[model samples]
Target chain A: MTTPIRENTASESPRAELELATRDALGALRHVAACLARRSHELLGLSCLPGPAGQGRLLVAVADDGRLERLLAELRALPEVCGAQLSRAAGAALVPAAPVAA
Target chain B: MTRTTGARLIADSLVRHGIKAVAGIPGGANLPLFDAISQTPTRIVLARHEQGAGFIAQGMARVTGQAQVCLATSGPGVMNLLTAIADAKADSVPLVCLAGQVPRALMGTDAFQEVDVYGLTIPIAKHNVLARRAADLPRIMEEAFAIAVSGRPGPVVVDVPRDVQTEEFDFTSWPAPRLGSGPAESPGTPGPADLAFAASLLARCERPVLYCGGGARGAGAEIAVLAELLDAPVVTTLMGLGLLPPGHPRLAGMIGMHGAPAANHLLTRCDMLVAVGARFDDRATGDAKRFCPGASVIHIDIDPSEHGKNRAAHVPLAGDAVRTLGALIPLVPARARPAWTAIRASLGLAHPYALPGLDDPKSPYGVLAAAAEILGPEAVVATDVGQNQMRAAQAWPCHAPGKFLTSGGLGTMGFGLPAAIGAALADPSQPVACVTGDGGLLMNVQELATLAELGLPVKILLMDNGVLGLVRQQQALFVGGRYTASTFAARPDFVALAASFGIAAIDLEPCRDARAALAAVLAAPGPALARIPVDPDAHVYPMVPPGAANHEMILEKRHDHAHS
Candidate 1:
C-alpha cells in the first residue's frame, strides 16, 4: 500500500487529476515533475506506488486544464512514462494500490 | 578461445557497427576507453569541450542518418553533455553517448569525480544503461546502437564504470545482434482498406495541403507525386525545410510561428490537411484547439506513438512515410485544384514580407541571400539559434534533404560551428556554410581551434548585431523596450580572434561591395569567418507574437519601428 505524496483543497479555477505509470529509473519521477511545472500545471498532489515487474506509478493533480491536453501528450511521450491518463473521479486520492504479483 | 577486457569489447563493437570516427575529450575515468580506442583503425577528433563533441556527433548522424558515437568522462564530463543529449532528443537525432563513471563499488559513495550520470541523463536520452559487469558490455553496446538508430531516432547513454572496463571473461561466443531490415518504419504497407480510405479523402478534397516534417525526408519523391495527383501545395516545418526544393512550384513555404504569411493563412483555410510525419508542436499549431478548426486531418507518421497525440487524426496512417505514401498513391485519383493553388500564390503578394534593408548587401537577410546565390543551392548550411537562424531559415534556398541543419526543437546556440565540421568530415566534396551571430559564435568559439587543426573547408558567416537581437526585439515589442542586459558592452575583434586560432577572416562591414567580399569568403578558404555588421535594432518581420495564433502575425507594415 502507498499514500498520496501531497494533496490540496479545491480552488476557484478548474482542476484536473492525472495518473502516470512509468519505468523505475533514476530521475524518472523528477522528469515528470519538471514537465508538469513547465506547462504551468498546479501539481496539487503526487503519490508513488510500486507497480508490476519493478515498474512505478504516480498520481498527480493540477489546477488548470487549459494546457492539459498538450501536457498529457508530452507526458505520455516521455521515454520513462509507460502510461498516462486522466482520473474519472475528480480530486481523488491515489488510486487503490494494486496487489503486487507474488 | 580468447579472453578480452570490456574495454576491448567496446572498441570491437564500434568496428563491427561500422562507426568510422568519434569525437570527445579525454579525462581520468575515460582514459582506459581512449587507450583501447587508440588500437583500432577508427580516427578520433579531439574536441576542446564535451558539448562540442556531442554536437559534432549530431552533425554526423544528421547527415548520414546513422547512429554516431560521442565519448565523455564521468561527473562534469557527463554534465556538459546533457544539453546536447536534450537537443538530440528534441530533434530526433541518432547518437550513442559513452560516458565513464567511477567503479561500480564507488557509485553512490560520493567518491572523487563520482556523479550519478545515469540519473542526470534519464530525462534527456531516449534510453540509457549503467553497465554493471564486464560480461554485459558486448550486448549493451550492440543494444545501444540498435536503440539509438531504431524507432524515433534519439540519443542513448551508456555509463561504464572504471572497474568494469578492465574485467575480462573468456570463451569467445558472443550474443547474436538483433539486426532488423532498416530503421523503424511500417511493419508492412497500409492495408487495402486504409489505403482506400485515404485515397477517398484525397479525391474529395479541393483545398488540400501536404504538411511535411523531418520524418518525411525519405519520402520526398513520393510526396511530389502525391502533391501532383492532388494539385496540392507543400508546407514544411523547420525540420522539414528541405523536403521540397525552395523553387518548386507547389511549395507554399513554411508554416507556424515566424513562418511565411501565405503558408500560415493557407493552413487555416485548407479544407483537408494531409499532415505527414508532423506532431503539431505548439510552435507549429499555435493554439491546439483552434489550429485548423475547419480541416479534417490525415496524419501519417512512422512512429505510432506520435499519432493523435497532439491533433486528432481522421485517418491515421501508421508506417514509414515512403511505404505508406507509395501504397496510397496508386489508389489516388489524378486531379488538379488550380483555383486553390492560385489563391495561395496570390496570398504571398497580399501579405508580402518586407525586408527593411534588403537592397543593402551588408544587411543580415541580404548577406544570407547573397551568400546562398554565390554558393548555389548545393551548399549545406548549418545555423546557430536566434535571429540569424530565423533569417537563414527564411532566406537560404535548401535544395535537398539534410542540407539545412539547425537546432529546430531545442533551439540550441553554439551548434553551428561543430555541426558544420561534422558535415564537412562526412562529405569532403560538399561545401559547408555555418550561419551564426556574435552571441552564438562566442558560445563554442573554442571549436575554431579544432577547425584549424582539421583545415576542413567550412565558411562561417557571422552576423554581428552587437546584441542578442531576438531577445532585444522581444523586449522592445513586449516589455516596454527596457532592454536590460541584452547588449554586449564589450565585444571581441572577431577577425583577430579567428587569426589567433589559425583561421583566415574577412570583415564585410567596410567593403565597398559586400557581395564580392562574401564570394571571396566562400571561394578562398579552408576555414574562414566572414563578419557582416548589422543594425542592432533590425528585426525579422512576419513574427507571431508570443501566445498568438499562427495566422495572427505582425507584418512589417504594422510595426512602428519597421526600418528603425
Candidate 2:
C-alpha cells in the first residue's frame, strides 16, 4: 500500500470526514482500511458501533486531499457497505483517535 | 436426500456446476477429497508442484471465464499455492481453491501439517472460509463459486479440516449455485443526461482517444461502434490487448511503460480520454501527474472502487461496459477527422516497430513473431514474465479476448507452461503456445512431467537467452553492465532435457531452415519443446523508466529522434 501525495486545489480543504454503514464483518472493515491505506488517506479516527441487526456503524475521519467525493462514492460501492456519507469533526472528536494503523 | 461425506459433497458441487476437470496433487490430508473426486468422471490433472496446479487452474479460468478449481493439502501445500492465488487476484481471474486442513481439534496446536491457512489467505483471496462442520460443505461450495466469479473476479479459498472431509452428513438437496454480491447484472442504466454530457464532450473534442483495460473485454463490438462514431483511436492496456482486432485501423496500439511510442505520444496529445475500465495503473500511467497531461478523463468501470482510484473521471459512469457503451452509442454522431488520423499515421510510420535481427528466426523477437504467424491469429498464447513475455505481447496478433493470457498485474514468472496446459484443456481444438524464457521455465520445470503425461497439444516456445533478459538489460543500461547472477553459469541442454521428460524436442538454432522447422514442430500432433537460441543482450524498447512520464520514453538507439 502507498500513500498518494496530495496536491491542494484552491477549492479543496486539507482534511475531511466520512461515516459508513457496513455489515458487521471484520473482512469488510479490513477491506476499507486497506483501500484507504492504498490511497494514502490518513484515518484520523474510527468508531465501530453496533447498528441494526448486526450491521456496523463505522465513523472514520480521513485526511482529505480534494478527492473526498470520489472516495465516498467508492466506499458506498462496496458490497458489504450499505451507505456512505460525509461528516465533519473537530479535533476533540478524536476519541481513541489517531490514524488507523493498517 | 443422500447421506454423504464432506468430500463427496464437494465433488458433487463441482459436478453440479458442470466442472469438467480439476488440477491438483494429492497429499495425506487431501486424499479423501481426491478419492471422492475419483468416483466421478472429473479428470484430475496431477501436477508435481502445488503452485503448478494453481496456475493450471488459472489457465482454465482465464480461458473459460468461469471459476475453476485446484486442490492442495495443509501447511506447505497451501503455502506453495499462495503465489498463484495472489496472481489470480491481481489479474482478476476466477478461481475456487480447496485446501485440506488439520483436524478441527488439532488446529492452533502445533500438530503436523497444521498451519493458519485462513489467516494467510485472507489478504490474497476475495473471500476465505474454514469449514468446521461437514454439513456446511454444500453451502460453502456454492458460495465459493459465486464469490469467485462475481464482480472483479478473483480466487476464493475454502479450507476444510481433514476430519470434515471424512465426516458423513445428510442433505435434502445440493444447493443451487448462485451469483455472489455485486451490482445487478443489468446495472442502473446510464441516464440520458449522462449520455448527453458524454456526447457533448465527444462533439467538442478535436483529438479524443478511447483507452480500455481488461474490464472492456466483451465490449469490443460496442468499442468499435464508438470508435467509428467519434473517429478516435483506441489504446489498450496490457491486459486489454484484444479488445480491438490486432490491425484495426483506429488502433493507436498499446500504451504504458514498454508501450508503443506512437500510442504514448498520442496519449500526450489527446484532448479527451474516454478510459473504459482502465484503472490507470502506475505501469500504464507513468508519473500519473504527467500522464495525459491536458486530457479530460471520462472513466467507465463496473467496479465503483475503480472510478477515481487512480485517475479521477469527469463522467464516472458505473455500469457494465457493454451496456454503458450500448446506451451512449445512439447519442454520439459519426465524424472523421482526417488531420488527426493523418498525424497518427505519420507518427506510426516515423517510429516503426521493426527491430534489429527481428527477421532472423533465432532471435527472441523473430521467434515470437514467426510462431505467432505460424499459429495464425486464433491461437492462444500464454507468456511468462520479463523480456519473452513483452516480446510476445508486442508480436502476437490477438483477435479476441482471452487469447493472449499472461500475468499482467502480478507479473509472475513460471506462469506460461501450466497456464498453457489449462488453456489447452479449456479448448481442446485450438492450438496453444507457451512462450517462456529459460529463467522462468526452470521455476516450475517439474510440470514438464505433467505435460508429457497429458500429451496435450501445447507447444513450448522456449527462448534460451541463458540470462534473466529484462533484469540483465536493465543492469546493462542502468547498473554499469555489472551482471551479477543474471547469467546462468551452466544452462540446461533444453533439447536433451525435453527428451528426458518423454517429449519430442527441436533445436531451432542448429536447424538449416529455422522458421520452417519451427512451423513443422508446432504443427505436430503432440506436445513438443522448441529451443530458440537468443542473444542475452536483447532488450524490449520504448521503455519508460520507473518514475518517468509516458512521453519521456527511452527509445531504441536507432529511433531516438525518429518520431520528431
Candidate 3:
C-alpha cells in the first residue's frame, strides 16, 4: 500500500518532471563513465580509448509513421555520427500522472 | 587566268604543301571548303566536335613535326577550339586553324553564326589574318603554315569569309622565305663579356645551383657539359622534367608547387641560382618575395619578357639556353667545396615527403619504376594531369631531356593520349608511352579510335582508381570528409573499350603478375592499352591543398578505426 505522491505545481506536471529526470539520468551515465576511465588505474584498471568519443546518444520514443526516417536523416547530418541506424523494440508502459487543464 | 573556286585553291595549296589530312566538322560557314574536300586528294576527317578536330590536328602535327591543319566554322566552332589552340601555344606544337567567317558584307551586321574570329583568336594564336579577297587564300595558307612551324612553333589562324570560299579566283604560290630571314635572329653564342661576368659569379659562390628549363631540350649535351664543369646540382621545372638524368648526383628533382622537397629547400638555401631558360612561374615560386631569398639570381632565356616578370634577377642574360650555357662553360673556373657537396648529399638522404600506401609492389610507383627500368632512357613518355601526372613527375626516372612531354603550363586533363599521339608522330622510330589516370583519359576517350586508325606504336598505361583521385583527396583533406560528386560508383571497362577500338588490351589487377603482360603490350608493334586497377579508396600522398604552403603537405589522412 504505497501512498500516491502529489504534484508540486500545475506548471511542473508529472510528465514534464519525468522527461527532465530521464535526461539527467542519461547525462550522469556518460559523466560517470568518463570519470571512471580517467581514474581507471586506481579504480577498475580499465584502459581509455585513444581518440575523443562523442556525447551519449539520444533515445527519442516516437510511434508516428515516417518519424524514424526523419530522425535518422537529422542524425546522419550530424558531424559526430559517422553513420546512423534505426531499431524497433518492445514498447514500455507509461505511468499515469495527475491530469492538468488541456 | 584559269578560274578556280577559293575553296579549291585553298585545298590545292594545302596538298601542295604536303598536307595529306584535314580535320574539321562541316558547317554552313565552311560548306564550300567541305565540298572541295570531297573532290580533292586531301582526306577530310569529320570530327565529332570542333575541339576533337583541333586535337586530331595536334596529334597529326606532333607525329609529323610539321604543321597539321584543322578547320572550323564561325562563332561557337571557333570558340570550342580555344582550349586546344592554347594547349598548342603553350606546348609549342605547330597547328593551323582555318576558321570560316560570315560574308564580308554582313560581317558586323549581327548575322547568324557571325562572330569576330580574328579578334577572338588573337591572344591564343601566334599570328592571325582576315582574308579580304578570294585571291588571298593561297598566300594566307602558305603564310599560315610557315608561321605555324617557324620560330617557337604555335597555332596560326586564317579567317576566310563564307562567300570568299565560293568566289572564283586566279592563284599563285607565295614566295617561301629562307629559314633565318626575319628580324628575329636565331640565337648566337653568349658574348665574351657576359660569359666572363657569369664566370665571376660562379667562381665566388660556393653553393651554386643550375636550374634548367625546356629551352635546353635540344642541347642536352651542352647541359651535361655545363653540369660537369660547374659541379652544380641541376633542378628542372615541370616542362623540363627530363632535362637531366635522375641518377646523376648533381640532378635534383623538379621545383614548384608539387616539387621535390630537396629541390625547394636547396632553392631557398643556395647562395647562387643560375636560371637557364626557365620562366619563374608563380606556381614554382610560392611567394616571389620569399623565393630564393638568399640566392643571387642569374637568369637566361630566349624570351626577354620572361626575365624580370615573376622574380627579380641580379644578372640577366638574354639568349638561348644552349648558347649561353656553352659560352659560360669556357669561362667558369672549377671551384670544389666539400661543405656544399656534403650539404647536397645530406639533403639527398632526407626522405621525400612520405608517400604512404605506395610501398606495395603493385602500386603505381612500382609500375612506373618497372617501366622506367625496362624502357631505360630510350622510350619517350607522355603524361596526363592529376595524380598520375604528379606520380610520374615524382617517381619516373627520365634519363634524357625532351623524352618526357606533358601539358605543364595548362595542366590539361585530356592532354596525355593525344600528346602521346603527337609524340609518336614526332618520332615514329621510337616507342611512345602515355601514362594517364582514369579521369584524365575519359576526358577525350574518343581519341582511342584515332590511335587505332593511325596504327601508331603508342602504349597507354591507364591507372583506374574509379574516382577522380586528386579531387577526392582535396575533398577529404579540406572539406571535412564530406564526399561530394567526385566519387564514381560505376565506370566503363577500359579493356573492353580498348578492344572495341582494335587495340590489344590487358587488364591487370592488384597483386597480379603485371610485368609480363606490360612487357608483352610494350613489345607489340601496333597500338596497345594496359589497364591497371588501383584501389578506389587510395589517395596520392605529399598533397598540398589549394592555398596551402608546399611544406604543409598531408602525407596521409587519418581515418576512424571503426570505419576501416
Error of model 3, residue B562, in angstroms: 17
* Residue-level lDDT tens digits of model 2 in B1-564: 788999999998889877899999888789999999999988899998999999999999999999999999998998899999999988888899999998988899988988888778766787777888999888889878877876668898999999999999997775764442335222565678887888888887878899999989899999988999889999999999988897797787888988888899888888888988788899998998888877777778877667666776667787888889988889888888888788788878876666556687888878888888899888999999999888888778888999999999999999999999999999878779999999999998999999999998899999898999888877776677788889998999999999999989999988989999999989998799999888787678878878989988887764323222
Q: Which candidate gets the maximum DockQ versus the true structure?
A: 2
DockQ, all candidates in order:
0.09, 0.18, 0.00
Ranking of predictions according to DockQ: 2, 1, 3
Task: For residues B68-176, write the lDDT of model 1, one tens digit per residue.
Answer: 9999998889888889999999999999999999998888999888898877776688777888888888778887887787757889899999888888877365575
lDDT of each structure? 0.82, 0.83, 0.68
User: Predictions ranked by lDDT, top down?
Assistant: 2, 1, 3
lDDT of 3 by residue, B1-564 (tens): 558888888887788878777788778889898888778788776665677678768767755668988889988888877788888877667898988888889999989888877666655666667888888777677767876776456788888888999999766455552222221123456567877877888788878788877666666677667666667788888777777677766688787777787787777668888888787766666655556667877788765545565666667776767667777877877767778878887876773564443344357877777776766678888888888888888877887765776777777888788778756755667778889989988887888887788788889989889888777766666677666898778798998999999999888674256776677788889899888777755666555445544444445544331112
Q: What stretches of model 2 exceed 4 Å from their correct place? A: A1-24, A29-86, A89-102, B173-187, B558-564
Recovery fraction of native interface contacts for candidate 1: 0.05
lDDT of model 2 at position B203: 81
Off by over 4 Å in 3: A1-102, B1-22, B31-46, B59-66, B110-112, B149-151, B176-195, B352-361, B374-376, B426-430, B544-564
User: TM-score for every candidate vs. truth?
Assistant: 0.87, 0.91, 0.75
From the highest TM-score down, the ranking of the candidates is 2, 1, 3
